[model samples]
Target: SFVASGTFSRVFLVHPETAKTRRWKEKSHDAQRYAAKVMRENDSYIQYTSDARKEGDILKRLEASQIAQGKEVLTMRCFDSFAVVDEVGEPYWCLVLEWLG
Candidate 1:
């Protein structure tokens, strides 16, 4: 897992390798990065979830094409999804995205 984090979801800084074997680095604010919009399953607002799903679908299609073309895709180019049990043990799905900066 790459450094995972977001405002709505609990962000974890994950490395591609095992957590113990990987080093953590903070992203520089001045660096160029991609922005990925992720879905927050626990969002009280239903509209947000709907919009996220729509965006995720569109992004997946675009990423598939880019990957096929051998283009340089940013981390944000691909959307990673996960589901976790909240403190109450309720399942929540989160979308991990690259920050466009």
Candidate 2:
């Protein structure tokens, strides 16, 4: 179900137990929950999609930096990302992130 929305994306809750596919559970391993940030699919959302993709990139860099420094995670981490065609045939960008809550 939809959980939240930001300027560039909408967030959806991903419960491992209820997920239709086992891919998420298998890929995330011990992770039990996730928040997926899906980019808006409208025609004028090009800028929004770019910004959302940048956010995902920055999150990945942050996680890498923390890992390199041997510091405990103090922030949400992204687990996966991909583009999927929506019901309307629009390709929407998606970033799967840790559900800190």
Candidate 3:
């Protein structure tokens, strides 16, 4: 479900099983979940989209900087990103990151 909203996007907390539409009636498994920051598709998307990408880029730079100094970033670790087109043909940019909790 939705966790929060930022200047340009909303965040959703999702589990590994959330990827599939149908749930399996089996034993539960331990897996990593993620916090997805999805870009807002609005009238200002043309400008906000770039800013949204910059957010991920900044996170990567911070982690890279810490790694270069022999340190580890324990928060907001970005995993992957992609664009999902909606029924209205609007492209929503998404950034998948490590969920802190």
Between prediction 1 and prediction 3, which has the larger TM-score?
A: 3
Candidate 2 residue spans exceeding 4 A from truth: 17-31, 41-50
Model 3 residue 70 CA deviation in Å: 0.3
Task: Name the lDDT of candidate 1.
Answer: 0.52
Residue-wise C-alpha lDDT for candidate 3, range 3-30, written one tens digit per residue: 9986777889987654444556654566
Candidate 2: tens digits of C-alpha lDDT, residues 1-101: 89998666788988656446666555555558889889843324545335556667889899999989999877679877787778889778788999876
lDDT of 1 at 18: 28
Between candidates 1 and 2, the one scoring higher on TM-score is 2
* Model 3 residue pairs with clashes: none
* Best of the two (2, 3) by lDDT: 2
TM-score of candidate 1 to 2 decimals = 0.44
Candidate 3: misplaced stretches above 4 Å? 17-29, 41-50
Question: What are the clash counts of all predictions, listed in order?
Answer: 11, 0, 0
- Model 3, backbone clash pairs (residues 3+ apart or across chains), number: 0
